[model samples]
Target: MNQNKRFCLALDLKDDPALIKKYKEYHWSGQAWPEITDSIKSAGISDMQIYCTGNRLFMIMEVDETFDPKKKAEMDVNNPKVQEWERLMDQFQIPLPWAEDGQKWVPMDKIFQLA
Candidate 1:
């Protein structure tokens, strides 16, 4: 049996409403580039979802037990399509003030969970 792990991360969109709109449009159902989605799944991520409130963005990512974030990052660094997508998306993204150097999405600590 394969077990999956869930990780929650947070990011911020450029404060401009126009940029936010474009960001959401890019992520709309079936709107993401095939290469990007393929890379995500191939990285062992089973599912991912992003939600936004105001300028804040939250992501819920589910991945298999063998998923290694460092490995995924290394893969992304070598993938031209992923790099291209990142560059394009960077225009609408503002890394969290508290994010580490070169980090886009900041991982959120799970503080509470009923289940």
Candidate 2:
């Protein structure tokens, strides 16, 4: 199997069950907005997956060797579609308390890995 860098990040959903259901719906492949996926690929993300437990969400992204989070973030800032998608998603997402202001999907520390 090929090896790639993986980034793990976490965020929380609004506590309302209805909102949580809506959030999950948006993540369904059939329901996902294509522009968002396109932007991710253009940002050098080879694969992306999201998981949820209760209101907490965990995102795993497999990125190309050249992927740079800062660069991707800068690109996202200039992409109207990406901004729109983020605004729509903001309805259901909440930053973790430990996250700095304006931060979303805070990066998680890697505690262990199997070799």
**Candidate 2 local lDDT, 18-103, one digit each (tens):** 99999999999767788888889988899999999999999999998778999999999999999999999999999999999999
Q: Which candidate tops lDDT?
A: 1
Task: Flag clash pairs in model 1.
Answer: none
Using TM-score, give the best candidate's number: 1
Query: Would you estimate the TM-scores of all the predictions?
Result: 0.96, 0.94
1-115 per-residue lDDT for model 1 (tens digits): 7599999999999999999999999999999999999999999999999999999999999999768999999999999999999999999999999999999999999999899
What TM-score does model 1 achieve against the real structure?
A: 0.96
Quote the positional error of residue 31 for candidate 2 in Å. Answer: 1.8
Q: How many backbone clashes does every candidate have?
A: 0, 0
Alpha carbon deviation, residue 11, candidate 1 (Å): 0.4
